[model samples]
Target: MKIDVEHVTKIYKDTKALDDVSFTLSEPKIYGLLGRNGAGKTTFMEILSGHILASDGEVLIDGENPFDNQRLTESICLIKEGDNFKKDLKIKNVLRIYAYFYPTWDQELADELIREYNLNPNAKVKALSKGMASALGIIVGLASKAPITIFDEPYIGLDAAARKTFYDILLEEYQAEQRTIIFSTHLIDEVSLMFEEVLILQDGKLVMQQQADALRDNAYAVSGATKDVETFIEDKEVIQSKQLAGMMTAYVYGNMEQAKSAGLTAEGIPIQELMIYLTENKGA
Candidate 1:
């Protein structure tokens, strides 16, 4: 499904959660929705999933609105960070309920995941540990087989090993059947490799949206003598720079080859670092 966000905006009292953000997700690829705290990542996901209405503009999935639209809602599954189910519901009941909501729900897969995660279906949501609850959410998200699967910080309280297990299963599921997956997480370094495209929000604004590989290929950290580095980056788009002890390193969005040819030591910037540089308060 093609997701089209056209000038979408959201407001909460005096704060603008989203400010005229526009982007087109035209392919079924894994997208990393990245931003720091309160950067409107959650707000954007809510608007996209129809949990909340946009204050202005619109979000269209295959040319139709998602809000209160049953057909689209069935095709969209959003697994949030926490509190995904009612406290009174048992694990089995939660799965059963979601199975009814999502026509494409796979009971077999859900069962397998529950066992794999070592979750007891008889346990109530209130009794499960934070990690266990997150595991339940992951199972629902993967088994839903929704055309658009949005996971917002879905693995809270999970240990590194458990998180890896979820990531492995997620990749396997995506490979088995391609669908749009929008993953929002704070552990950027851990999941950055899975992102085909990255969209970054900064202070309620769309700061960067680009192909992950292209971003890695073009963005570089060039280091050399302060004067030489300064001269080389003068005409380039510098995301950030630091000078120390006569040496300067400029995080630049430009040709790596050109930087290398200019006698500067250039290295590709990791997506996580790139995001930090792009979103940091440069004026400071």
Candidate 2:
């Protein structure tokens, strides 16, 4: 279930969604695909799931190309943003149809999830509330039991409680099934602990890919007097900085020891906040 993206690129008319991005993923691990809006995270997932073709280069699953390949498609389920289910179909009917299509579909899991989420199977897809619709999508994705499950913002309309439930259920299923999960999300802090590795995209390009813990350790936020912060960061790679009321906080992308020596209080920055800072000050 390893995924390999080599020099992959995608262009839409006047815009380039992906710019020769490349990465490799081993199976049986949770990966966090992180980025700001319009960072090509969605485009990368779409190419991997065979929903869209890469404008250049290749996307492969276990050495085989996944584009339009039925065998590979059946083993990879992608729950993308927005409602993709047929509006005319009932929730029960949709589940039934999916069960028939995927040989590895788990009926028991689907049934349990439906009840746990308090969803009415008889309700038409279009009739369900936004939260319920997202819940249904989650059920289908997990029950499909696809070896490679890619979830792109699957908790869009879910409340905080419901979203926590989804994460808990996902962890339970992954531990029991040992499947590869690629989660693309903006709620980085909520799900950061679950990710073994992280892939960060910036403006259609791969900015960084590394072990989650290692990446966090490599970067930090240092705060002190405005002048002190400036002097401290003079020789370092300051990813971002903010000053207010004579105090300054700067995100320095380097070793903590260096920051401490410069008389700055270096603290770990949460993944979500770090991403926002990075994407916002990408040019700085």
Candidate 3:
């Protein structure tokens, strides 16, 4: 599903959650929507999923507005961190409710996930553990088969092994049938490789949006003598830099080959480090 977010903004009382952010996701690829707390990641996801209306601007999925549009909404599925299903309902009943809502729901996949997660369908949502609850949410998201699937920190209490399982299953599902997956998670190192593109929001504004491979292939940390490093990066797009004693280390978003040829020790910057450098309060 193609998404066009044009100057989208959301205000809550006195605070602006999203500030005229605009971007276009025009392919069926897994995108990593990242930011620290209060960066408007959840707000953007809510608007995209049709749960809420934007205060200004619009969120378009395949050229159609998402808010209050049942046809558009049925094609989108968003699974948040917690409190997804009703506490009084059993797992099976919850699945039934979701099946009714989603025309493309796959019961077989849901049943398989229930067995894999070792979840008893008869158990009520109130009785399940935190990890179990997260697993149920994951099952619903994967089985919904929506063209657009958004996961906002979907693994809250799952262990490392369980989270790994979810990642593996998600990739397998994506490979079998390509779909647009917007994954918002703090576990950057764990899933950064899965992201084709990355969007970063900071302080209610869109700060960065770039291809994952481009960031990995182009962003570099070059360190050497202060004067030499400074001269080398004088014309480069420096994301961040540090100078200590007679040595300097500069994180740049250009030309790894050029840095290497300049005799500076160049290493690729990890996505997590890049995001931190880009979104951190520079004045602080």
Cα TM-score per model: 0.98, 0.92, 0.98
lDDT-based ranking, best first? 3, 1, 2
Full-model lDDT, candidate 1 = 0.94
In candidate 3, which residue pairs get closer than 3 Å at backbone N, Cα or C atoms, i.e. clash?
Answer: none
Q: Give the poorly placed runs of model 2, Cα more than 4 Å off.
A: 226-231, 243-247, 281-284
Candidate 3: minimum summed lDDT over ten consecutive residues — where? 275-284
In model 1, residue pairs whose N, Cα or C atoms come closer than 3 Å (at least 3 residues apart or on different chains), thus clashing, are none
- Total clashes for model 1: 0
Candidate 1 per-residue lDDT, tens place, 70-119, comes to: 99999999999999899999999999999999999999999999999999
For candidate 2, give the lDDT.
Answer: 0.89
Residue pairs with colliding backbones in model 2 are: none
The models' CA-based lDDT, in order, is 0.94, 0.89, 0.94
For candidate 1, give the lDDT of residue 98.
99
State the displacement of the C-alpha of residue 7, model 3, in Å, after optimal TM-score superposition.
Answer: 0.5
* Model 3: residue 135 alpha-carbon error in angstroms: 0.4
Q: Looking at model 2, which ten-residue stretch has the lowest summed lDDT?
A: 275-284
Q: Which prediction has the highest lDDT against the true structure? A: 3
The sequence of per-residue lDDT tens digits that candidate 3 reaches over residues 1-284 is 78999999999999999999999999999999999999999999999999999999999988999989999989999999999999999999999999999998999999999999999999999999999999999999999999999999999999999999999999999999999999999999999999999999998899899999999999989999999999998898888889999999999988898988999899999899888998889921
TM-score of predicted structure 1: 0.98
